[model samples]
Target: MIKALIIDDEPLARDIIKSYLKDNIDLKVLAECSNGFEGVKAINDLKPDLVFLDIQMPKINGFEMLEMIDEPPHIIFSTAFDNFALKAFEANAADYLLKPYSKERFLEALEKATQKINSNAPIATQKIIKDHQESVEILDRIVVRFGNKIHIIGLETIRYIQAQDDYVDIYTHEGKYLKQITMKYLEAHLPTDKFVRTHRSFIVNIEFIDKIEVYDKESYVLHLKEGQKISVSRSGYSRLKEVLSF
Candidate 1:
């Protein structure tokens, strides 16, 4: 079901929109806002998929409200004015329903909005997941024991790793530190294509790699293409060749 938020200045207008939404089996009116300020706040907090937005209001207008939110929802402009039709479409609005439009017209606009929502759902879900994962501060930094005192190391600074028995030694542009985690478990969170395990004990950052150092074997030694010398196993080398189309 598509969660919807309604924003209109008039109470009767709100009632009319609510009645129309009642017939839409897929729509649920999650919240109601009388003005654009409240609408912006509600949208940011609730993150609804569909918004029934009125163009003209007391404070901020519909267009301005869309500008304020970090991630705007599928907007269906509910307005009395038809002059803004060209501008609304230019702004990539999902759909628009003119005031006093019949149920048939509203259904048409609603269906159009639904199709837009469905088409973009996958991309939007990915963004949400990425944002959630990146924003999580749980493992953003790690504490390293430097002689007697502990040092804080940023996770983003890590460039590579080599497994040493039960502990993994981390290599970064800054320096190296030992962390207690298996290579298999750590690979799950990192981008696999970007970071590859060349040996049973090592995982290197591909971006920092300088060049592939070919020795006795023809296998592509991940020279991090940068300056860092990281080895690539025969199996890992084959996978990288296919991935890079080499």
Candidate 2:
């Protein structure tokens, strides 16, 4: 039997999915989650083979929850919003089921998911996530997972970002969180007026800058409000100058 999980905010939506799956004897409903936080915990503990995921939810969205998982199961996106249909396909989702869909449509998506799971197909979720991040005009917040804990960091709270090999360390007033993301992606997506790429390895929030001083003949350093010093490259200094108008 294929284990499945239904994750949606609306009680009625979850009920509808359960009713539709009653006749599918081969698929078993493992758990039902009302929000992304519960969905993440359920997915981690249950390890479902297929997930009927909803896009918009409390705490985090479907995509953000997917980001928390290292190896996400075959997902059939079910949402009322049509704006994410293309992105869902790009993420190599099994299928995108728009809400208020018929039983026939749900069955079709289930068939696709079952086939992929049975075939043991690889999910290119990371690439799709990266592409999605780049496509975002501006990022208002960042979601990061540390161990079993999930943190939602707002742009205003971010002090700086530091590159760490394949990951980037996001420093906020609360603490530092590591995320599997690129500095290039963050540089492009973060608000330019508020954030400045200060060095090859550092992106600093302008609000957190306490002062700037010369580090050497060719480079400079920034002192943050939290008493942390960040190195600034030549080109980085130029960018800072333009942004700070100094």
Candidate 3:
């Protein structure tokens, strides 16, 4: 039997989904959760193959809750808001079932999800999460999973960003936290006026910069307020000078 979990805040909505699933004998309803918190725990413990998830809930919303999951199950989003449809698809959701949908619509989504599961197709939820994050806004903060704990780092607190293969080391006053993001993404997303790419491998926060000293006629190095010196590429120096207006 294909195990399924229903996560929604409304009791009526939960009942509706349960009723719809009654006819689909191939998929068994394993659990019903009221909110994202319970949903997370239930998903972990039960290991459901598919989840009927609602977006808005108490404590954490659907996207935030999905971030907490190490390996997310196939998701069929059931939300009232149409605005979330694009983001849901971007997250590689099996289907988006807007609230008040008919049983026929529900069955269509279930069939799609069932096909994907049967094919053993890998869901690219992580990439979808990253793309969804960048689509929202110029981020004031970033959420990162460091070991078992999650860290929310304010963009202003970042001293510099250094590339490390596929990942980047985020340096701050507390220490450095490794984030699995590209320099290209950060360069485009970070506030350009504040954070400047000082080299091919490094981006420095302009507020923390003490001074720029010439290494040669064309090359230079930046001395940060924290007493760390960062190499500046020839082109980087030009970009810095344009921003600093000197």
Number of colliding residue pairs in each model: 9, 0, 0
Clashing pairs in 2: none
Instruction: Give the candidate order by descending TM-score.
Output: 2, 3, 1
Instruction: Compose the digit string of candidate 1's lDDT tens values, residues 129-225.
Output: 2332333323434444444333455556677888889878888776788765568755655666666677676777666656666754755556654
Model 3's lDDT to the true fold?
Answer: 0.83
Question: Per-residue error at 112 for model 3, in Å?
Answer: 1.3
TM match of model 3 to true structure: 0.77
The predictions' CA RMSDs to the true structure, in order, are 14.4, 1.5, 3.6
Which tens-of-lDDT digit does each residue in 105-224 have in candidate 3? 999999988988889988755565565666755656765656655566888899999999998999999889888778988888898899999898999999999999999987899999
For this target, which candidate reaches the highest TM-score against the unseen true structure? 2
The residue-by-residue lDDT of candidate 2 on 76-174, one tens digit each, is: 887787454466465554478877999998888888778888888786555555555655678888999977988889999999999999999999978
Alpha-carbon shift of residue 96 in model 1 (angstroms): 0.8
* 2 versus 3: better lDDT goes to: 2
Candidate 3 ranges with C-alpha deviation above 4 Å: 5-25, 28-47, 54-71, 79-94
Best by lDDT: 2
